[model samples]
Target chain A: MRSRADVVVIGGGIVGLSTAYHLAKLGADVVVLEKGYVGSGSTFRCASGIRAQFTDEANVKLMKYSVKRWKELSDELGYDVGFVQTGYLFLATTEDEADVFRRTVKLHRRLGLGTRIIDMDEAREIVPILNTEPFILGQWNPEDGKASPFKSTFAFLMRAREMGVEVHEYTPVTAILVENGEVMGVKAGDRTIKADAVLNATNAWAPLVNEMAGLDRELIPIKPFKHQLVKTEPIKPGLVNPLVSPPSWNDSYIIQDAEDGGVIGGAGVEHGPTYDVTPTYDFLREVVRWMTRIAPPLKYVHIIRQWAGFYAKTPDSNPVMGEIKYVNGLYIAAGFSGHGFMMAPGVSEAMADLIMKGRTKVPLDWEWYDPHRFERGELRTSAFQIG
Target chain B: MQMRAPKGVMVLGQTDGEDPRENIIICRCNEVTQKDVEDLIDRGITDIEEIKRLLRIGMGPCQGRTCIPLVMGIIARKTGRRMEDIKVPATRVPIRPVPAGVLVGELDEE
Candidate 1:
């Protein structure tokens, strides 16, 4: 590992690697430190769904840009990331939920996203086995879809390595070296690697790193929430083409991978902050119940595997980015809640621009995701946080 | 002993001079060939889980029972890792396949 670099990113998940790759592309000396093997964290466990049908304008814009990047990612990275634009179908059971979908679709279309509200018949046409009895309508975005998380993460890692970004695996950052409220470097094991800037891209574990940087809990307030998912044995392909989510069904989602023919689905369960990633019977039952309700044919399907991971949740369900106000050169890009994988492409580029040029040319509502928002008591309304 | 083929019948082990290894199916449920596994391994995807996610190697009805060890051997051979050191994929719940209907109970009960 190098003893010094222009910037040191403190994580090696998709976000960190993509950011490192982008930073290296910008001609910055970058080093990525991973506590475990690359993508062994939440990236490996993620559902890998990418979408832009968000209620918030900023989120819509950001994800639309991200989807655009995902479309071209395979060519850009010189590796197929398995990106498929099968679309994302958001089901609505109640009038209130339908109203939210209506408004979100309007906002999405206004931002040049071709998301539209579809009737029950159209929804059934998209997913032939969809249980339309539970959902009155669905919001469909054909531009949004799913990708291979492992492929994308490895793509970025390989490209970053090719671009001379040094990556050290199984090297945990023990401390963020702060002197007089200015970032110096990080302490990993017995060595100290001096750096001009340090970024806390350790999503679920961002709080621990932030605290190490002397940021108070009140100032950042990022918490980890455990989310569980299950994969069913491969059946015939095209059973469920799009990523389907019903907001009323515990925020459940079911999508079948076209390449693999395995049906992957999950649901949210109310839980406090935790680091536990053990798969639970309760989560399995809940996901099966909700998924079977969404698509009754899934009841006959057999679950092959189950796992859990963390969503680095902030109060407003938005990420905290940008440099720490009182601490110079200490930047953070964590607290993505559950949408980091999809937002990675755009986030990495914007974050790279921020780190190198001190501001991002990529248009996004920067103030809403400002690292000082918690301190200033300026939390924006939560983004659409469906599974 | 040499087996003689009938006038219209082909021998069991004969493939008309094709590569016999191409007929070796590592994952029968998915029809994944030995070459498929080696091709991915050649691409630097040595991890079993990453290979599974990308190629759908052991994601079929048998749930990796027949192919996991075979793929592990291939990876161990290709990556120079010992058989014991190659990480296995996680075995998930129900152990055996349980129908989701059984878990959710009767439809009328809801």
Candidate 2:
């Protein structure tokens, strides 16, 4: 690796590689450091669903912008990221939950998103096999979609390398070298690479990296939570085009990949915060129970694999972006909770703008994702978090 | 009745097939040819999981039972790495393919 660089970004997932690509496009020298191979972290384990049907206005706007970028990403990178606009469906089983959907639909419509509250008939039209007995209403957004996380992450990495960005795999940063309250660089093994700026893009490991920089955990409280998912053997393609979310069934979500015909699904289980990524038998049983309840045909399918990953959760379930005020030349783009894969495109563009020009051009409410929100007591309502 | 060859095995004295080596199928379920596996290896993707995700090599009903060892051998030959150095894909639950109906307590009607 080079002994010096203009900027060093930590992490090699979608966020880190996309940020490196954007930074290089803006004429900034960039270097990306990863503890493992690219996309081996949370990016590979993500469900890969993208949507703009969020309750929060800022989140909706950000996702809408991200969807636009995702549509054009394949052409821009000259590699197919497997982005398909198969739509996202959210089901509500009670009147209270339906009321929340109504409010969210209003907010989504106001933000220029093509989301609407659909009746049972319209919901059945979208997904014919859906069990209508469980849900009273549904939220549908046709613009929302899914992409292949491996393709997307590698697309960014390959393009970033072509644009003069240096990426080093298996190079773990041992310590953040801070001198006289200013960011110097990082020490990896026996070598020290001095950089003008350092960005902490390591999602689940952000808190640990921040502590290495001598920042208090209370300043940026990021906790890791383990979530598991399962993939069934290939059924028939296009069986389930849209991502199906049944909020009453432990927040279960299901989607079928068009390329492989495999039905991928998962559900949230109550567990304490930890970094352990061991998949549990209890999770498989719970998720399968809810999945088979929604669609009986899935009961005949065979599960092929199950794995777990971490979500770098914040207090309000939004990301923490922008520069750190306590330390000069130190920036961070982390705490995405579980939505990092969907939000990577827009977040990278906005982060690049913030780093080079001290502001973002995207029309997002930046204050909602301020890194110091917990300290300022200005935490907004958590976005409608689901699989 | 004539006995047909297995899904991925090549029959001897078959001269009608064109480019016999490249046409050889490695993943019978996914129809992934030797060319497909070699092209990805040529592009510097040696990781078994990445290859599986990109090409759907081991995602079929057999769950890598028929193709993983063959693909690992090809990777070892192309990258000049020892077979032991190549990491194997992680094995998951339901070692034998168990239908989801069995997990949810659904039995066949008598």
Fraction of the reference Cα-Cα interface contacts (below 8 Å) that each candidate reproduces: 0.66, 0.66
Q: What TM-score would each prediction reach against the true structure?
A: 0.91, 0.93
Q: In candidate 2, what are the lDDT values of residues B9-95, reduced to their tens digit?
A: 667754344455556788987889887888888887777777876777876767788898888999999989889988888766656
Model 2: per-residue Cα lDDT over A1-387, one tens digit each:
788887899999999999999899889989999998887779988888999888878898899999999999999988889999999999999999999889889888888999989888888888777888888999999999999998899899889998999988888989999989899999888978899899999998898889989998768888889998888888877778899998878889899876787888889874548877778988888888988888788988887778888788998889998898888988999999899999999999988888877887776567788899899877778867786
Candidate 2 chain A, poorest ten consecutive residues by summed lDDT:
A269-278
Off by over 4 Å in 2: B1-21, B108-110
Best by DockQ: 2
Distance from true location, Cα of A282 in model 1, Å:
1.5
Query: Against the hidden true structure, what lDDT does model 2 obtain?
Result: 0.85
Query: What value of lDDT does candidate 1 attain over all alpha carbons?
Result: 0.85
Ten contiguous residues with the weakest lDDT in model 1 chain A: A359-368
RMSD of each: 3.6, 3.7
